[model samples]
Target: MKKLILSLTLAASVVASPALSQTVRIGTEGAYAPYNYVNDNGELAGYEIDLGNAMCAEAKLTCEFVTNEWDSIIPNLIAGNYDMIMAGMSITEDRKKTIAFSDEYYPAEPSRFMATAGAKFDFTALKGLKIGVQGATMHAAYAEENLAAGNTILSFETFDQAVADLAAGNIDLFLADGDPLNNVAEASKGAMVAVGEGIRIGDGMAVGLRQKDTDLAATLNKALTSLKKKGVVDKLIKVYFKDGPFYSN
Candidate 1:
């Protein structure tokens, strides 16, 4: 975990606002495209950003986006580095033990394995293959717990590195969120393909908060519930994911 600099820690304290204030800082990892990522123009842009802004508006609060590295995002939030976290984070019981979560804004997305196109394997008899996963992620934990028995597990700091390694044949497969991996596979244009069944491991995605921030959790939940009812979340998912309005039911 990355430690907050003394100055940044003080700044975080200064920037922290009340639950119903006009402003709240939302921390995100700006590397997960279509969900949360930094654009070439050096601006935060994605489905989470749009949805978070809409939720803030619904709650009559202004939201500011803060980029944090994935490994440090949770600890930093607990350290008061940001008011809340709205990255493409799933709401799992394990995570709930560490932090509070608003009502889910996005449905649970399954995890899938990506491999170089034309690569074949007897997955049932799989052995001696290297699997790449971003470190400290649910996928990493899942892979370690389930797949490490017969394969070498390679942990990377970023999804891009894992994908690059896969493309370069350094790793046999890369496991990640299905939507983003699907997006990347499509962008690869026959270079990469998703293999294996979709693994559903957690609940839907939501805003992560300090476990004690009950008021803020309630405020965000109220806003998210309203947005879901209004179909804003569904529309935004379609805009970014080009897939299902998953919560329309």
Candidate 2:
């Protein structure tokens, strides 16, 4: 019994140590705009990028971001290739089984819809319309749950590809956050529009952290809280998404 107790204590100590911490690599889907996406120069930009840099500063740690495919971001996180995920990932009970989340720092309504102009439709009225979402996203899960079982649900890697498929009439509609959908719609010159009423999923957006690094998660949360207080988060939201629906005009 004494030996077991000592082992448990030692294990706890290892989990709590920061020196054992890595370079704090963060994972993001560089394909999702406003939240995270590649800029014109092929550099990472968006709210997550800004918030992540601030968090690193607050934590007093060096950090780097890797553009990862959305479908496998969490899986790769568990595999130890990265330290945290901040791709506008939502805090959901379904995901909590494998990884932990910091307190929700940025929460907003999940994106939805992909209908052509002059097509009057309601998501509830369409009992058999097919929908597309990025695989492994909260939007994908929501589509699976809300849409009819007979309604086909497709998954894609990038939002741009999903929008392309929609424009080609390959799928009935695409679902994602409002910011990306709006960006895609404008870029397509009105080929698609988010028609159905938007839906909210889970509590809010949060950083996905390895289960073992609760301390690191706490540190990130502290940074997020500080940013929230200093109006940095709100300011960034306005700058990036002033004309978007999620933010006021």
Q: Against the true structure, what is each candidate's TM-score?
A: 0.90, 0.84
| Per-residue C-alpha lDDT of model 1 across residues 2-27, encoded as one tens digit per residue | 45687788777677755436568999
RMSD of each: 8.2, 9.5
- Judge candidate 2 at residue 109 and give its lDDT: 62
TM-score of 2: 0.84
Off by over 4 Å in 2: 1-22, 243-249
Q: What would the per-residue lDDT of candidate 2 be over residues 1-249, giving only the tens digit for each residue?
A: 999999999999888766654578999989777889889998999989998988898778779999888888999999988989999888888999999999776656656686776666666666666788888887888878877477899888877788778777888878777766776767767767778787777777889999999889888888878877787777777777774333222
Worst 10 residues of 2 by lDDT: 240-249
